[model samples]
Target: MIVSIKADIFNNDKNSSDLSDLMHFFKKGRHRMNLRKIDDFSAFENSQWKQTLSRSDIDFLKEGMTIVDKKEIIVSESPSDSEFRIKEAYCYLQQPLSIVVENYEYEPVFINCIFRNFGNELITAKDRHWLKFENGGGASDNTIKGMIKELFNDTVFTKSKEKYLRCYIIKDSDREYCTINQDDTISIKKLPEAKFRFLKDMQIPYHILYKREKENYMPDSVYNNFLQTANKNDKKKEFSRIYLEFNAHQKDFFDIEKGFSHKGRLKNRKSLQADVQTLFEKLKDGKDLNDRQYTLIGSGLPFPNLKSDFSEKFNAVNRNDLEKRIEHQPLLRSEVNPADQNERNEFEHIINEIKYLL
Candidate 1:
């Protein structure tokens, strides 16, 4: 199928990067917050590295059972006859790609979209949907939660909450609407402490503005107190205390960015520039990204097809590059531009490469 390709599909004037850089980049606070929540050995085990307990060890793994924990429940993985190997267990999570586009030929042809992966990050490999195809299609939160239930075989929730009230409704392909039975618009001023709590919980590394640009922002007094209790370090680390409003919009944006940030350190601007250069190179090279890598692109940025661009630009002749070359277009809202001349040059190089090959 020769799907119509256009320059506007991928072009963006607004600055946007992959979810890796935007969502989860500054999580010095999350690490600290997670540390405080480490009450048991299981808590100490990072969720990323948790061992898959044998099916028999947990009673919930029996075929077709829902494992309940507090208000949450674990439903088994969608029953499938597909392959399941220790090395490739995540290959089974594929469902038809559900996508939606506003207008194939028009201004804002590509709008912003969101994709929620069930905790099992590798599941998207099976198939993908074009956002333009569905009226309001995006990633399915219900599907993801169902997958999560199957993966964990047990749901974890706070003891106080009853009946799984925090369910998220899977809206179209990119947007997952939260159904927390609360007001639609959550404000920053209402939850003054949430911002500080979020920063402390995420442990993000960032520069802040204190006293209206008078001094570099440091952690607020509340954050300092939390750190004192959480860090337990006899010697203090360098603290940049600052007070800033982390309202709902900032929280939502940053939360997604934090989740999508690159795991490695981009210490300085020079280092960041180098990293960005390499990032474009990888995208142009059509690399087969694992779940984390793909998630970095989807969750971090405005473009869904960014990774596909890499695959198309790099592995055009390779048969496995089907998704990357053609099927990888995503419902993107904006495009990220390089901030400096050097960055722009690198970006333009990739764009030219796309023009030549794609």
Candidate 2:
């Protein structure tokens, strides 16, 4: 977390001592400090506060603390003005800003949060499963709206009183794609436009997933494990078998939440049906159907049977196993993509954004 310091806090000897202690405390932890100017007071040598600090403290201020204009959680001595403030030394040391994820128990987001805040600590399987049972599902439109309303209320009514409270939201983009041309190139569309507007209007910081959702980012090993454990009679076992045969592009764009034939559940039902038909038409010439065409056609399943929730079930099982491994190791990057540079970069970008909020 980036802790911002008020320039006025260094105006006196007592405050200077507190600031020095705070700097040392922050240095020992992962948190970074930003020296901010308050009102007309400058934090530099030209200001009256420059005389309060000892030579070493001044040297540390230059070399150690990060100076930035942005404000996150503020550390202040005398109350001036700031939404999230740490007024005293005790509160500063004890309380860190909480990060609000879409679902706290979702392993992909939770593991990243844990990595940013606590580093790579080994978590027990029992505790991990407990988290999974507690709010592990994706947030609905209504749920996201309620969260946005709560954040607005907190910012308007509570934060005005200077009580320290800050939160960052991260959710999947839920983007979908379709084949755009004869070359099998795809065009992506970002879903849930209203939610993006709400977050922006509320001035809340957030990160959206580059892929469709958390399941799309799961490692190949997770799929293999799910296939190994699945019952031979299970429909999802068959679905997993077909899914593993897809190319990288098909896998990346596939909808894990609702398989290719979720017309009833999807808002763009007509467009989805059209895409399926278009892919089918392109491959109907009887020259062997490619991976992309096969994927879009519901893995060659009968139209009536395509509506089965096999994809959702397959996703759930793979996600659960991935969560177990993450709890024990917390190494998302290593498991996410070891060979693909683009995928690795995307994973790193998401993690760095989450860490910045911390």
Candidate 3:
């Protein structure tokens, strides 16, 4: 799939030009030529019959592109996560590249790395060993890829080519080896365009060449689709179910108008208030306040506990206050209490008033 763009130079059709000029052109500009083929979409955009091959048979069109200019790399560490930037991308011809990176403690750690190729001299590390270096990542592709991910929260891509291939097997994390694939050592050339493309795809605008850059954050159209989920949720709604139980048998009869003793009533009300307060206090203490609801002839405080539409809205005390303030309240609902009869209406109304005291 990745072939030279100049293959059409060998097309032997009648409409093609002579081959001599093609050879001369190659000789003159071979080193500077960019080997990208026509993109699929652009190739299909032309007329069906007028064909793209130049009138010359032996000659071909040279793609207009620039070989990336080399730049000096400023390799340094930063104080915080936001400051680190990816400064290099190394390509490997072999399946796995062994890397020894310095950890945060300055200790060297090793990992095996593989990558995903994004055509036109760019690739991103696909998988890496679990162990990592601390300073950022261990030296090698791990550190570079980690820095890139930290900066853009996206994958990193860098330039590479066949001629840049390394001809050796690394025997250790230090890059030591006895097997040699190439007899000569070659210097690496940094490709800024590849870095540019990577950053651009990561949703970063403005230039990275300067500090204190000003740019607005624009979410991709794909990210915009997330709001579709918001309509299904309502923050103002309370839980529809109530975890409640009340016992008419346990009701305290307080006849204050007849000058009757209210000590028993006060004691019962205080115990109930204490229990309710404990629930709220537990929540404030970051503890769960999940208590079972009892019904009918239960001995404990016989009051209905309101359950919210969601567990996270577990402010039972506040919800009770709001419900009591409302003029219209839902009718009492109890599994054991007969829904077919309103015999317990006066009792339920008195018990529900406990919300006003809490």
Candidate 4:
């Protein structure tokens, strides 16, 4: 299946311009280099000064330029098991401040920087999943930074410049975001409005977002702190901030593994408790577990106490389904009638054990 990805773009930590323009940029004092505090671009170009340039900057410039215009990502595949890499565009907004660009949408939206609405509140897009990018129109007054200041410096912008904190996803044909309808348009459902804040600039796309607590998105200590906040409303805001900040620091580059894969984590562990009985029933009745159940529950429970507890619950499952895979003697996926076995699986004793702690 083809899924489109989108988001607003922010500019940050950029001093390494073209090889030829490096000296001119710094000699004018309009540029700043965070590359180990090296002040001169000419000095940066010197061979010995290579050490001062960030390896990340050099890696990004591998295409021989600083700017990346567009990229295609593989989102999913056909049921026949054929690979399907979805083509996604990262088109910069055309006259973004003056007009709307519709090629793609933004991801993990930064709230404070979204386009303005009538009351300067949340706005809508074509769908509930749409995001807003920072409007890049206002000029900065910090003349000391030169051209870069207007485009890149946040501190230079006057308080008069309006920064809208919300956006909408009604389709352009629906014409919901505009104050005066741009064309004769029809309005669909106006979706939920949300709040956001600016994200820190990072050069690569993110692998995950922390919309809520999950083992992959959060650590135990951080999650424990999140649990400490008493008010439910405040907790929601705090989580939104965490998601925004975490997403802001991520960048999605092309030609890499750039899609969601940890679906096994979404399994309902409590629901799986019933499946555990079916699993042992099949095993005790001379049946076996499938490859998915075995693979997802790899390496058994990490904690010994949890394993001991789980073992007590199912006497027949003392040996984990995962450990049955010997190098040569592979576990069978269809040794019995699949209809005879429980259809819903991918659950193992270890999976439920982890969930019990949460």
Candidate 5:
């Protein structure tokens, strides 16, 4: 985080002692402290705090901070004033810097769209989202295409080049099913080419979901929990029953919102069936079926394909329950299949990339 130290600390001995402690803390290399080239230096020069510092401490302070002409500055106040002053400031350091284009500040993350309930829950989960940053480093759900178009605007793009806006993008791959190769590596049969191209050309870091969408990552526990509290309606009960019975592979790729059959979306059904059939055939000859294959076998032929029985009203209610469950338990790495060594840890990979931006 870029921080600006107030020279007013020189007026008080206690504030000066606090400032000294902060300077020592910065030397541990946890954050970057920057001072405005002219204004901040001039203030420091006129302040009496320097008189309290020895020659080595003065030199260390100078060496520790960087001088920049223009940068977002976190104004450092007296630590004694707030119990969590240091912690709060450190939290800000863990967020991506705001993109300042022509004096306008913008968020660093762009996503296709946020789920009305689930999206907010995932982004705002205390353990997942940055407390100091807006919506976890300010995610903009203007759609990937929309954000790319905005970035391509001549004036905005050209002006932004000087400041170099660092951004990360998260988009649903919308993959029907991922192919598990002979080597156990997973690959998407198809990707949204145009959107990927745009993001790649602009040099933005991005993560495309391995599954169909965020809802696919919800664990079985969430569905079961929802079932227990759900209204005693036949459709609701049926949906829960079918969902609970789904194999891990089916659960991972299933469209939670639309269910197995929505309209004539044959693509989802075909892909899922083909993937499962291939796996079933490959592992059936083995002495014992793996957990994945066992689940596949349990699903049975024709795959109990059903259109979502949820009414629009109940759908909203179910989604809210999803959000609540995820907020409480958080998405586990296992839920996204961290066992795929080729992919490694998908959740951690996304997190590490975001942390890099921060």
Candidate 6:
């Protein structure tokens, strides 16, 4: 299997034009260097500069250079494991070089700086999993400091330029993926085989599944935030931001691991109904809430047609109206399973809990 890997290069802590020109120069040589090598070279270069250039100007030059080190990374290419490395360097030379070019100065302004490899793994190819990359074999960015840390290392200098870096993924056609439809509905593709089974086994309430083919690309800023909102305890090192939609009688379904892994009790209905009551109280207290919050709390509740008296009495408003009322009054919906007595009993227990809390 051959999986396409996409990536981008980001340079921070310097001006765009300066960084671009420097990158052009670096590209002229197919070079690789480790952190210590770059640092040693830089130290030697700085010693030479100390004897030749003014201290203030050298400090300014140091401010202009961005440094990086090389590393090796391993990846799976499907049925086989592969490794790659990235060599990068950080340098601090501008004025001295500019002066040297003018012929009056024998001083070298720019230094080759620090270079290292940032590691990235090729997890899969053509939808098939393969062996994991062994450590210390290739150059790459595997750590947070190398991966995206530079972009945030300096706020005033690098934040806006982040737009230059592009991130891409090659997904297989068979699995479900998230898409924003033109009509503003978040849609999903063909869901994973286990997600459906888990939903059924757990009695998750989803009323429909539709093939979503809409294209409404969201800006990276918004999308990036959404990706960052995953559960804190989740081992995010292995997961990317991938979501799919499933229509239960409720609106707005979003969960990725549920599709990938067997999430048996993650969406247990009784707990969800309790969440609905909690959301309502928050609204009653005049809190500002979003559609997702409402949907999350509501998804756990029993809908309008349960024969249970508690459900019939509490489910007074429809979904749309409930959303409107979320400003001041949140509706109560129970997660009721008409066919499963165990589910019904658990739901009743939740209802009693809600009543006691009220």
Q: What is the TM-score of each predicted model, taking all chains together?
A: 0.16, 0.56, 0.14, 0.15, 0.45, 0.17
Better of 1 and 6 by TM-score: 6
Q: lDDT ranking from best to worst?
A: 2, 5, 6, 4, 3, 1
Model 3 over residues 1-358: C-alpha lDDT tens digits?
Answer: 0112222222323212332322333333321223344642233224231263445521333342333221111111222222212122111111122222233332221111011101111122212221122342422334344444443322322222211211111111121011111553322223345434532344322112110000000011211222333244421111101111111101111111111113423222224443233322222234433342111111222223211121112112232322222222234432222232443221143222211111
Which predicted model would earn the best TM-score? 2
Q: Candidate 6 regions off by >4 Å?
A: 1-20, 23-39, 43-57, 64-166, 169-249, 254-358
Q: How far is candidate 6 from the true structure (C-alpha RMSD, Å)?
A: 25.2
How many backbone overlaps does candidate 2 show? Answer: 1
User: Which residues of candidate 3, in runs, are more than 4 Å off?
Assistant: 1-219, 232-358
- Steric overlap count per candidate: 58, 1, 13, 25, 0, 34
Cα lDDT of candidate 3 equals 0.23
lDDT of each: 0.22, 0.46, 0.23, 0.23, 0.44, 0.25
lDDT of 4 by residue, 61-83 (tens): 33222221112121121211222
Report residue 17 deviation for candidate 6 (angstroms).
15
- Please give, for residues 1-358, the per-residue lDDT of candidate 6 as tens digits: 1111112111122223333343333332211112133543354243432344456544544443332221112211122223211121122111111100111111010000000000112112101221111121111112211323454343222222222122111111222333444573544445565433432443322212121100111112322343476456443311222211222111222222132122433333334444333322333234543344434433322222212321222223232322221222122333332322332221123222222111
Tell me, what's the RMSD of every candidate? 27.1, 9.3, 29.4, 24.2, 12.7, 25.2
Which portions of model 1 miss their true places by more than 4 Å? 1-139, 142-222, 227-261, 267-358
Query: lDDT of candidate 5?
Result: 0.44
How do the residues 55-114 of candidate 2 rate in per-residue lDDT, one tens digit apiece?
A: 866676566455432235665555444533343433433434334455654444434433
The alpha-carbon deviation from the true structure for residue 167 of candidate 1, after best TM-score superposition, in angstroms, is 6.4
